[model samples]
Target: MRLIACIIAVCFANLLYAQTAKEIVQKADEKMRGKTMQAEMIIKTIRLTWSREMQCKTWMKGNNLAMIFIVAPAKDKGIAFLKRKKEVWNWMPALERTIKLPPSMMSQSWMGTDFTNDDLVKESSVVEDYNHTIAGDTIIQNRECYIIQMIPKPEAAVVWSKVIVCIDKKDFLELHSRFYDEDGKLINTMNSYDIKMMHDRIIPTRFEMIPADKKGQKTEMIYKNIQYNKPIDDGFFSTEKIKTLN
Candidate 1:
């Protein structure tokens, strides 16, 4: 009887020590995005009318600072975007103008694609701005995953009303996400796949964004290479650097 009681006590204690939804999100975010990251990737937009691909190099420092410099397709070459915290700016080399994104444009399409401007700017901080609850668990792509629902805090300046995220249990990689509107209607879905060994870590190199209301249209980003935890100074995220980067 004493042995059985001890075993039961240990099991209950272990259950109490399990991770919560917020902790799971933080762990997944840290595993995927280290302190800093530099990557070269291609963006592909597929629509009913046309399909186009553009290549760019991206540098991200923490969750707030990032810059992308387009390098391909003569039309978009030399264009860059700089994101610092809540602010975002676009450098248009052809026009020689650095346009700052206004608040109203935050939810608009990014570069005429399915992705929103907020997606590139990354103004939302999941760990800091959300109230997360582990709604359930399921298998995604033959791997166990925790389905976590995150609602924006009252003071969080986020566009999504709610976000349901699926994180793989083994790798902590984000497998899928569903964004909803304030009225409790589905807005769009994002999925990550094509797991690869990049820079000593397993990650989903391919990200696809599909609108819940639109068919035959989607936007995807394929990461060709990424180096995590690289040394990058704050100056790299400056507007001048955005215009000058090749």
Candidate 2:
């Protein structure tokens, strides 16, 4: 009789603590990205054959505008990309040309990295494009998390068929995420680590992504500097600016 009573008590507690998957996702997104943000990071692409580290600065405003410019790797410097609404443009300083990226190039890898151009440009908003369901709970890095399975809504413009996200329960940090293909096969997995206070928010300072089928390939992004909700001119996210400014 005591065992039965204890089981019921535990179930009741879990029910009270559980959150809707959509709510959990929104909270996690809000924690990471606020209105306008500017950040500098280094991306290390580790391959069995070769490894390289690239540095860049990025600026983003909501879901509409984003711009990134490479600052390091002397040979690849002055390369920039700008995205606004559904449009994307790439500036090549070596060629002195600004080419508009077509929709067909969305799936191409960015800078020869595991992340695709669409992933780098972020043409879609995660919160708006997907229908989220509370799958269950799991533990990541010794922290309890809310596991959410997200599927694209009808006619939503998204590439991934499904994405599973694990968000830390206490601070709403996204600890890990898995991307699946249209056939429901896992394609890539990304993990967050080294949680620390940056600016005003506590977030993971390091992110690593690996392809499921590739054993010797991975990409790691380390946040060197970040400032959220900083004043940024809308005019700055333009092809003209990308062509001229570094």
Candidate 3:
């Protein structure tokens, strides 16, 4: 009877662990939904070996839509990018024009940053677009992580064929991701670093993207003074604001 009781307890413990991991991921996703952020970032291009610092703002509604507005360095001021559904558009200050980004260019580098254009914008939820499986448990930067593999669902429109993510075991915050192309070739790796206190929660302050083929080609995004869940007008995301914002 004692042996049977021990076995039952072990099974219960395993179930609890699985539930905890799922809750962690759900919390992280919930915190990011319907939020706006303002930041100053330094972008470095490994290919050109050049870097630039700029101020920016972003608004996101759920995982499907977001917009980033650039506000600094004079030359880049008033420029913005909008992502809605599967479409992306860029607003240029000099030309006072909006240009729609072609699907083929989604993988191109974003403004000389190490991040691809797709990386700048968030995509559909990993749970919605892919089938997630817990790969294992590991440690990343001293924090226990649940290593999860996400493969695109059969009907999902995803650029990468597969993605591996490490989520913090305690907070469910995403720590790292490895992206693979359709040919099963590893294309890029992204790391989240420098956790900071934002809105009473510890959040990653810097996100770095590095290409697998280009040595020393990397982009690092540093977010400062982030405030979440701020009140923002829908008009802020409209084309009118894109035209007049500076």
Candidate 4:
């Protein structure tokens, strides 16, 4: 009977810790993405030999909708991408057609950058699709953080086999995350830096995604301007609406 009691206590403690870890992740996600947001950003894809830059305006509503319109780079102007719920579409002005992105394409690099399409559009929910557990603690950039480990649920369609993230304790910022593949090989690392006050929230203004095996190649995304909790209509993220932007 003593052994049975100990087993039950351990199970209960694990369940409680899981809930706490999930809540931490949810809070950090909410801090980054408010109810609605409009922002302008610049992305630089750097390689040892060459580098490319692109500028765009972005709108995001909750976790279900997001749209980006490329406004710079004369040759790539008028290109846009929209994500509505589980579907993603890309609009090309030169081709004059909208391409629906399939699940297989989500893992591909976005606009030749280190970030994947899923990273930009957020097709899968980090909170909903993964089981969270408190891994440990660490300090990043002088800020104390809670290290959380996330494993994909059996039914989830996420790409990473395992994700370990460090969340700032005070502000709930995601300071860093390491992504592993199915074979438990480290695939990429994302580091968030340049913390500042954007509108009413304190967050990271610059994010860098670096490939694990690649050398001298990384993508940097920096926010130029952002407004949180703005009012944006749902119609703005539709396929028909994206085409009209061109």
Candidate 5:
């Protein structure tokens, strides 16, 4: 009877840890993303030889809807991407056509940058599609953080095999994340910094995604302007709307 009691206690403790981890992640995610958000941002792809930069405007309505419009660089301008629930589409201004992105294309790079198509489309949600566990705690950028491990659920069509995120304990800010490939190889590391108040909410204004194998190559995204919970119509996320976005 004593052995059985010990086993039950251990299982209960594990359950508690899992729940706490999920809650921490949920809060952190919500803090960063309000009900609706729009931002103008710049993405710079840096390499040892040369670098390229592009500006874009982005909108998000809940977890299921998102849109991005490339606003700079004469050649790439007016390209747009829309995500409505599980479906993703790309609008090419040059081709004058709309392409529906399949699950196979989710792993590809976005706009010749370190960020994957999945990163922007967000077809798989971290909170809903992965199992979260409390791995440990650490400090990042002088902030105490709770390290959470995420493994994709069997039914989820996610690109990463494993993801570890560090959330600041006080503000619930996501300070850093490490993404691993299927063979348990580290693929990328994302760091968030320049935390400040963006209108009504506080968030990390700058993000950098560095590929593990690429030396002196990384993509930096900096938010130029942001507004949270602004009224956005659901129709704005449609493929028809994306093609016509100016």
Candidate 6:
């Protein structure tokens, strides 16, 4: 009788642990939904050996939909990138032209930086686009984390074949991610650090992207003036705003 009781307890514990992981992911996803973030990004490219700083704002709604608007120094002001479904469009303020991004260009380096264009504007849904598996528990920067492995689904339209994320157990925030290519080659790694308070919520203030092949090329983004769940007009996301934002 005692053996049977012990077996039941172990099974129940396993079930509860699985439920916790799912809940963590769901909460993290909810925090990112229908939100906008403003930040200053410093892009470092191995080819150029010089870093360029640009100020930008990103808006995301639902899943797999996001738009980024650039507002910065004289050169790159008023540029915007719209990512919806599997398509992407670039609006250039200087030329006053809207250009569709080709599918092949998704894998190209972004702005000569280590990150690919797809990495810069990630639009894949975590639930539908990838298969998630728990990789057990680990500690990252003193925070208890659940290491999850995410592999692109067979029908997913994503550039990376696999991604591994370290999710904080307490807050469900993604602390780090490692991206791999279709050929199973390591591509780049992304880390979210420097936690700060914004809009009454604690969030990562610094995001870093580093390439596997390029030793010196990395891009760091520092978020500031972040407002969450605030009213945002639809017109702010329209192509007209891209042209006038400069």
Top candidate (lDDT): 4
Tens digits of lDDT, candidate 5, 1-246? 999999999999999999999999999888877899899999999999999999999999889999999999989989999999888999998999999999888889999999999987688788999999999999998999999999999999999999999999999999999999999999999999899999897899999999999999999999999999999999889988987887
**Over the full model, what C-alpha lDDT does candidate 5 score relative to the true structure?**
0.93
How many times do residue backbones clash in model 5? 0
Local lDDT at 216 for model 3: 66
> What is residue 45's positional error in candidate 2, in angstroms?
0.4
Q: Show model 2 residue runs off by greater than 4 Å.
A: 1-19
Candidate 3, pairs of clashing residues = none
Q: How high is the CA lDDT of each candidate model?
A: 0.88, 0.88, 0.75, 0.94, 0.93, 0.73
lDDT of 1 by residue, 88-178 (tens): 8999999999999886677788877778888776778888888888788999999999999899999988878999999998889999999
Any runs in candidate 1 off by more than 4 Å, and if so which?
1-19
- Please write out the lDDT profile of model 2 over residues 109-185, one tens digit for every residue: 89998887887888767788888877888999999998888899988778799999999999999999999989999
lDDT of 3 by residue, 105-221 (tens): 877778877677877775445656776667798999999998877788898766789888898877667899999999999999999999867765688878888888888677777
lDDT of 4 by residue, 124-194 (tens): 89999999999999999999999999999999888889999999999999999999989999989999999
lDDT of 3: 0.75
The list of candidate 6 runs beyond 4 A from truth reads 1-23, 33-48
* TM-scores, all models, native as reference: 0.90, 0.90, 0.83, 0.98, 0.98, 0.83
Candidates 1 and 5, the one with greater lDDT: 5
| Decoy 6 TM-score against native | 0.83
Q: Cα-based RMSD of the predictions, in order?
A: 4.6, 5.2, 4.3, 0.9, 0.8, 3.8
- Candidate 5 lowest-lDDT run of ten: 118-127
Shift in Å, residue 200, candidate 2:
0.5
Cα RMSD, model 1: 4.6
Summarize candidate 6's per-residue lDDT along 170-217 as a digit string, tens digits.
777789989998899988898888887766677777778888887776
